[model samples]
Target: MAISYDNTGRGIKVLVNGVHMKTIPVLLLEAFKNHHGKIAFDKKRRITPEERKLLHSYLVYLKWIRKLRKTEKHLYQLIKDTYPVATRKVITLDSERFELVLDNNLKIKCPEKIYLLFTEKPVIIHSNY
Candidate 1:
């Protein structure tokens, strides 16, 4: 997978297997006001580590969503509304793996890079929430 920031630096493009999958705005102001406590938005600066992790998790989730859409359209529709809205209970990242703990205590693991742009870095975590 490949990830790239838009020319305006306010959006991201996600590609899997060299195919574009999704694009989402950075929404720095909203993220700072809503999710990132004590963090400030800086258009002239690069994204922080936290933001990078968040983006990686989001891309993984999007990849899952696309797969579901192709294989199980009805199930995808049933869960789509809630999936993205599901709170992330925990997120861990490093150089070899990635893990996501969702609000329902379900965990997801990806040992390989889902986005080529973020190779080697791994994320892992557990959550009770």
Candidate 2:
């Protein structure tokens, strides 16, 4: 998957497997809240470090999903319904770790090791094992 800025430089174009997907705004400020837990854009609409990290993680996850959709059809079908809901929920990636805060107030921790496998290196298992 590849992400590029739109010609206007105000939105992002997400491409999967060389196919163009929909373009969304570069910054989804409404999907996030401020440090004080406020969801208003009173201050400047700047992308914080936490937001940047969360966005990067989301992109990596999307790429992984695209790969899984092709190689693991069953698994992809099982989780497809949850993907949209999960993406719409609030996410926070701070010094401690990555966390997904759901609408029902349920908190889920994102595994860094799994993300590393998709973004950095793949884990290889020998047939002998």
What would the per-residue lDDT of candidate 2 be over residues 27-67, giving only the tens digit for each residue?
54223212123222233344455545555555555666678
Q: What shift in Å separates residue 118 of candidate 2 from its native position after superposition?
A: 12
Runs with alpha carbons beyond 4 Å of true place in candidate 2: 1-7, 10-42, 83-129
**What's model 1's overall lDDT?**
0.46
**Candidate 1 C-alpha lDDT tens digits along 30-104:** 333233332334442445676656655555656676787998887667556432322222333433334433445
What is residue 129's positional error in candidate 1, in angstroms?
Answer: 22
Cα deviation of 80, candidate 2, in Å: 1.4
Cα RMSD to the true fold for all candidates: 12.5, 14.0
Candidate 2 residue pairs in clash (backbone atoms < 3 Å)? none
- How accurate locally is residue 18 in candidate 2, as Cα lDDT from 0 to 100? 54
